[model samples]
Structure formats: structure tokens, C-alpha cells
Target: MNIHVEYNTEQNRCWVRMDDWRVAFNTAAEAEQFVERLNARLNAPHSWGMLSDWSPRPGAKARANLRCAKEA
Candidate 1:
């Protein structure tokens, strides 16, 4: 991912930019810290697992599967 920490002279603030999204910070140090943390998180190994075959219990209502439940 393309990311950069930059200072905006017009706004007198620093920001971390990732593509079209920009997160502003009051100081350059804050922006740099944010970038460092973001990089760390991105580089860390992910333990997320894929979903297995799953279903609601027998005799259960639609609400038992929250995804199948309609908004009230």
C-alpha cells in the first residue's frame, strides 16, 4: 500500500495519506507515530480463519440466524 506522512503548510498540520484517504494530526510526530503503528499492524501476521460449514439449530426461528432476520 502507498502511504506517506506529510506536512500541510496551508493548514499547519501533519497528515498520514493512504491513497485518497487522509488522516490529519496536530503535529508531524503524531502523524509519523500513526504511520509507524499502521505499518506494524499491516506487517503483523494475521490469524483470521475462514468460515466453516455452519447452520442454525433445528427448530430455530429466522432470528436464530441474525443474518436472515429482518429489520424491525
Candidate 2:
């Protein structure tokens, strides 16, 4: 997957745009640091996960299953 990260310091925010998904974060950080710095820098939500499955195939039913927790 491709992720485009853009930062707007004036607004104290960062945006993560992906081909099939999008999410907004306060600042870009390594996985470990995201938790440590999540509260201070976050004006809005620090991060959000976009649903990649927007629609189902003709023969498939739409469903979402969180397989497991990821590091970040």
C-alpha cells in the first residue's frame, strides 16, 4: 500500500492519505512514540483508521473483521 503523509504545523496536525484509505494524526511518529506523545500534540484525534473495504464484490457480502491489533 502507498501512504502519503503531509504535515500542517500551523494547525498542529498531520494527514495520512492512502490509495484506499485515509487517516489524520497530530504528528507523525514511530510506533512506540505514538503512544508517548499522543495526548500532548493531538488537537483532534491523533490517529484514525480508514476502512479499506468500501464495497463488496458482486458475490460477496460486506464485512469487517479486525484480525488483530497492530503495532501502529
User: Which model scores highest in lDDT?
Assistant: 1
Position 60, candidate 2: lDDT:
33
Task: Write candidate 2's Cα lDDT for 16-61 as tens digits.
Answer: 6556765567557732244344333433443334335333453333
Query: Candidate 2: lDDT of 49?
Result: 48
Return the TM-score for candidate 1, rounded to 2 decimals. 0.63
Give the winner by TM-score. 1
Give the C-alpha miss distance for residue 72 in model 1, angstroms. Answer: 32
Lowest lDDT block of 10, candidate 1: 50-59
Candidate lDDT values, in order: 0.74, 0.50
RMSD in order of candidates: 10.9, 11.9
Q: Give the local distance difference test score of model 2.
A: 0.50
